[model samples]
Target: MPTRRRFIKCLIALGAGLLPWSGWSEMLKIVNHQAAQAAILTNDSSAKTLDLIHPKDVSYLYHTAADDISALTASDFQGRRAGTVGEEKAAAYLIEQMKGLGLEPLGDLINKNTRNYSNAFTVYPVIEEFYNGRLTFRPGNSQDLRTPCANVIGGIMGKNKSESVILSAHFDHLGIFQGHLYPGANDNASGVGCILDLVRQLVQEGVKPKCNIVLAFWSAEEMGFVGSFSFLQNPTFSLGGLKAVFNVDTIGNGALNDFSVWASSDNEAVQAIQSAASEHNISIPLASHEGYNSDQVYFNLDHLPAVTLMARDWLNKNHTPDDVPDFVNPEKVALANKILYKAVKKIAY
Candidate 1:
């Protein structure tokens, strides 16, 4: 809200008595101008394209908390309905949609009898026996239950296997607690929407990657990256061929104008993201290993590079009931998806 002239005037006043007011003001202007010019120097520092995805649709992704997300937050165990039932339902629905989008199955997973979709992975197992009742307030901890948990993953094999990329999001969310249900409208349903939208875009645009593109919808991420970890343990494709992984963990929590990127310096995904961001004039709150978190962890652990891009700071409504659909900014999610598509086009190709 503060004007450039006012900013310079303040700077001049701060530097007064040390130099002439006129000279200080001139020097401040030159410094400010140079700073602004410096911002334009790098290709990865500017936003070039944004229309790749629509703004209104992005808003829709955030505000539409359709379907249940409680599955991600459910406490299931081995052999039992590990995690949440809602999560399992979400995974099933995602697989059906991916198949509808024409993604080919890479191998036999989960049931092993079927090769139609990616296998399921478990993030955490709820040992019902651990509940002392009085010690913890969470439900069903008193019963021993082995819940079978899994995340749905699919991919379009790239022309060049060695240069593959991953586009991922978590589809599971907090289940019902007591008599109430946590719809998880924005806590992550928004991310799933963005992912789905991208799938629609790829199918419509006939965009094929030089490198394989993995559409990953992680499970149990809310339980400490369980589903992602499981998938990495037994991936359908060779991890050696991976170039980078792009994760969309949460993007509809805030207004559409702001976005954030968490990337590891140890990988090449950082440059790819920076390049796309700059070209589209997108502003990214950048980071290195210090604050990077998302489904990209699997690749990072395997020494493969990756990035986590989102539209807003998820901590505000993260893990809370307030993370509903209305609080999400759809335009931001759409833009993030657009940027992601651009990044894929540049990096994988």
Candidate 2:
């Protein structure tokens, strides 16, 4: 039998030193990942003794993340509108809270002078003028339009560390409209909170996947996945190395215990989602569905593997002032995270 101490030693030897004060739950997850790594290096079949980790250990992640959903959607953020001071504040908040997660700063998108983790980009938003009987578009925006939005990122490397898997969510929402701030709690603040909680907790336990985990908080999704599209076109890193993408968006409605997934017939991505849903006791009422309404659509349409999670009834509370954090159910957000955790674990390996 592989002793726990030996597993710890093996992890340190492989350059994944323990923090010494990590709890048993954290230790368990790290031990399992390191054991699997050791087995691969030694080519020893018996070394494949990694146990199925219990999800209960990291339950704190869900709670903290769920609770913070309110903060992310608070009036202080001014709706986290893409290209506005609100969006910048939200990005700064995420970067600050997400420190030490092993994520490298994205290319020139991030401000070079500042330490905020962001993928800043300049996008030419189409401004349509409703003049006469026709509408025409011009590249770029007027003074009032938000021009500079940022995508936030972080990561945890799996075994290979070269192949990549993306866990994404859009954090931008409609700005103040008609004297109302679109709190955007459900539009995607919840999604952002969930992914952050999921990645931060896993990294806390030093749990590594079998492929690099890319944590992407996209911007300008309201303007049509501008941030994600930018990254795909002129990637700081290649998307060709991407194995899969899981997008979280608008999951704060519907039955608090249920979820809806938009996954096509792509076997690897679809099957993994189904399997993880089943294992985690999350209900995916249908085996296959397709949607192009959210950030994942950019990847899925281009033939890159992707899946999206949203509520079946999210349409009710989305894109309005009512979409405030008060409408977000923390329990459901936590459950969504659990399902993704299982799904990512299954796919990354």
Q: Compare the candidates by TM-score and give the number of the best one.
A: 2
Whole-structure CA lDDT of model 2: 0.69
**C-alpha lDDT of candidate 1 relative to the true structure:** 0.59
Per-residue CA lDDT of model 1 for 178-272, tens digit only, reads 43445556656777777677765554434456677778877766555667788788876677877778788778766555677776453577667
Give one digit per residue, the lDDT tens place, for model 2 in 1-349.
3565576767555543544534443455556555544554464565454322223234343235655577777777888767778888888877765553445554454345533467778655555333343222344554544477778876665677668888989988776765777788888888888888787656544545677788888888876788888777766556777888888888777787677777554546656666787887655754344434677666776788887888778777566677776788877887888888888877776
- Candidate 1: regions farther than 4 A off: 1-82, 107-114, 123-145, 161-163, 288-292
Model 2, stretches more than 4 Å misplaced?
Answer: 1-63, 100-102, 107-116, 125-146, 263-267, 281-292
lDDT of each: 0.59, 0.69
Give Cα distance to truth, residue 296, candidate 1, Å.
2.1
Cα RMSD of predicted structure 1: 15.0
RMSD (CA, Å), candidate 2 to true, equals 8.1
